[model samples]
Target: MRKITFKTLTKVFLVLVFSTTPSLVLSQVNPSPKPKSDFWNHVQFGGGFGLALGSDYTNITVAPSAVYNFNEKFAFGTALQYSYIDQENFYKSNVFGGSLIGLFNPLPQIQLSLELEEVNVSNTYQDFGEDYKDNFWYTGLYVGAGYRTNNVTIGFRYNLLFDQDIDLYGQAFMPFVRAYF
Candidate 1:
């Protein structure tokens, strides 16, 4: 087996960062002489949720995010994510994570986005009259494209470094929705 070291991990991480940074690193346009008075101006709220309930299974997810639009074509933001799952007589899991998000719109109806995140996941279970808990770090790097409208954004993203065993996003391809405030 190949032993994974911190140095190797760091190099991989740096490469991902550098490759995505350029598109989002452009200079911001100078603001107009008259600024808007409303605090909500140029700001937007967006996120997604999932819920499932059954006799033997329960799952809930709440992900909230905020973004500041630099212009019609550029924006930067952050996201807070949480999810909980329980299976009767089986196990329970909890997840918490946050991501730095960057978005760019090259056209009026198309948007490209990237997100980097670090997630902490914990699971608890009982076996043979014994209880145990496990915790680990799950990192994600995603690249996506969306269809934009006046009030909503619909997108699909693929996690470039998703791990089937540790990541909260169960599938590499995930759909997302966002509404503007």
Candidate 2:
């Protein structure tokens, strides 16, 4: 009688498994190519919305964007933004903006994003006088990353040049979301 050593048994087990497996299993290891689709198939639509209400503060926001994929790895898009804020016994403001956006996907589930925006804001001071309006243009740049799924994405971004003195967005960190059509 012969006893099989551990090393010999491992070698024998591997040989049997490989020899018994069908050649079809090994041949199908390569991934399939992506299907060709129409231009419209690569278009996606989604955006972010915000609402805040309290005795001392009221804010509402509407932002929407459209994205077209140049390829599986790159996309470019645009966004329209509007926000209004009214503070108790203080002031009221209206902000309108538009953004140019770009995205890069190095992996199937990871994304990198960049955005540039121009915002025009109108402010009416209630404490000072009646209908005293101030207007200005603000430029914003953002950089962020997120996780993506077949139909949805969730991400966070930072305002690279946040103006703390202005007090529009008190925090530099902002969240973003998207849904594909």
Candidate 3:
């Protein structure tokens, strides 16, 4: 649909803008001779595939996230994720969520983050509930972690559905590659 196409375009644009933020900072740092700690303040963008634990199909999301350190060990950022999955009942769905992630970089090879997200879902072959309710309205919380380097990064995430009554949720483990600024 035109709307989904527009939204996807907007996502790509914003990711490019945010992912370039550190380049400006890097230029400043190069002239100033800043410490290695300045590297952690850079921006990160990641893309990869996720294996949906419960369904007949796997999920894939391209997420671009950024962080600004209030200090060396602590940082805050937002992640925008878009995903699609297939189910056994001939149901297919697309999801979008925004999360506030608290980032921890204990070592150069590892990064851990705790996230709280709101997710929205759309089912392609069936209605979400009995009445359809506009074929939308899904929200949830997600907690995830990541390990990264200059070449690639591996990530794992677990989610809890807060808007649905069945107490159902899902887990996604993703191995992604990212380009850093």
Candidate 4:
């Protein structure tokens, strides 16, 4: 006669049950493949917002973009954003920009990014036309970093302002926040 200890009995039971039901065993082994690599590759579309600080003007920026996630912590994407500013008491301007971005999320509570961007600024209500609109063409490139937590993302970047300003040709620091979905 043989005596079966509790551990031996449990092993025998599992083998008998699993051998009869492979689906049950397989289900226990797999758990949905790790959540599709962090929203960009999984979600078809997403959006974010920013605050642009410039020497002449400050503006609120909003953008909607398509995201492609490389993994659980990184993404590559593009955004189309419009900007507006209140300049010099009764002066205003509108701008449009496009950015190609790479995002790095080291922790779930924090994210960092670098962006290459092109911007165009158009002043509508100034005293002069081509003279004031001379500041209109703002083709530039920039590198930026960002932080994110609780669905809100904040970021900063320095840009090489190009093809427009002669005397004021320099970089600008921009900080922004947006809801990530």
Candidate 5:
């Protein structure tokens, strides 16, 4: 009968471990193939909506937007906006527009954005006993920053093209909430 010594057993154990370690490392380094991702998988859709109503006033807004994520840090998108406003015996207005958006993320929790917008405004106002109509096109360029979490962002933006005399948005600074899925 033969007996194995502790030193001999330790040598055998070490040989077994060293022989299998390379295969284990190689297997992790060369994993199985994965399926390719689809184009739509990188596209996200989101927007904003608002409604206000009173005895003498009514307002409604709809904005739909979409973005294509090029990577974890960059995205490009577009948005369409429509708004209707009516004030009893005062004025009625329709505003429609579209915008181009570009976004960047410096950190997982911070987002920066640039947007260009063009809108057409048509308004009818009651001047005493008569109606007056005005129509025009307006353009806006905005730069913004926000806090981001998951698919939602809370931010404020400043319009570079805003004019106090024009009264387009009444002010250059605007707060916004954005989300995407």
Candidate 6:
């Protein structure tokens, strides 16, 4: 056989590569389209409410919250709180505020949380037939752990910034029941 020149061999090699590359690439291409993302599918809404009535006292509370689940184990959320209290002849007050919360689940049944809250308190105190007003803003940072079920969690949180002089809740520790849907 006649000697194959280097230029001729190079041309043959390039032709083989160019002719086979398209078919090789096409064979590996995916046929299915990717699914679109749905934003609302990752969001959950829930909160807490309370009402108390007595001969000399009345209290009502409403707190609504929503969370965006990043995955099965992490969530970030926000909440709005409103409370009305009337201690008959002593005082009447309105507390309104909002909070930012972060939650983490290390196990399916255990949850941990951190929250920062701020509230505006407006109080009218009855003193010797005179009405005295006090208005202020209160801030709290809380860290907590809880037992968690599918949509409910029962736990207690301790406020790191609690002050008895403010007397908002009168204590540094508070119990909470939370649910989400």
**Please, what are the lDDT tens digits per residue for candidate 3 over residues 1-181?**
4456888989999999999988977877756675666665465544334555653666666666776666646667777778876665556667787767776768767767677766677666655543222245455555556776753546766554443342224324333343334
Over 1-181, each residue of candidate 2 has an lDDT whose tens digit, in order, gives 8888999999999998888786768787867878877978888998878899999999999998889999999999999999999997788999998999999889979888999989999988875556677899988899989898976778888889898886667878898886666
Arrange candidates, best lDDT first. Answer: 6, 5, 2, 1, 4, 3
Per-residue lDDT of 5-39 in model 4, one digit per residue for the tens? 99999999999997879887777886757756454
Question: Candidate 4: TM-score?
Answer: 0.54
- The Cα error of candidate 2 at residue 171, in Å, is 3.6
lDDT (Cα, 0-100) at 110 in candidate 4 = 74
For all candidates in order, the CA lDDT equals 0.86, 0.87, 0.61, 0.67, 0.94, 0.96
Record all residue pairs in model 5 with backbone atoms less than 3 Å apart, i.e. clashing: none
The sequence of per-residue lDDT tens digits that candidate 1 reaches over residues 27-68 is 353445576676578899878788999999999999888999
Residue pairs whose backbone atoms clash in candidate 2: none
Q: Give lDDT tens digits, candidate 5, residues 4-70.
A: 9999999999999999999989988847677777889999999999999999999999999999999
Taking all chains together, the TM-score of candidate 5 against the true structure is: 0.78
Q: Best candidate, TM-score-wise?
A: 6
Which candidate tops lDDT?
Answer: 6
Q: Which is better, 3 or 4, measured by lDDT?
A: 4
Off by over 4 Å in 5: 1-37
- Which lDDT value does model 3 have at 32? 61
- Which sections of candidate 2 miss by over 4 Å? 1-37, 128-132
Better of 4 and 5 by lDDT: 5
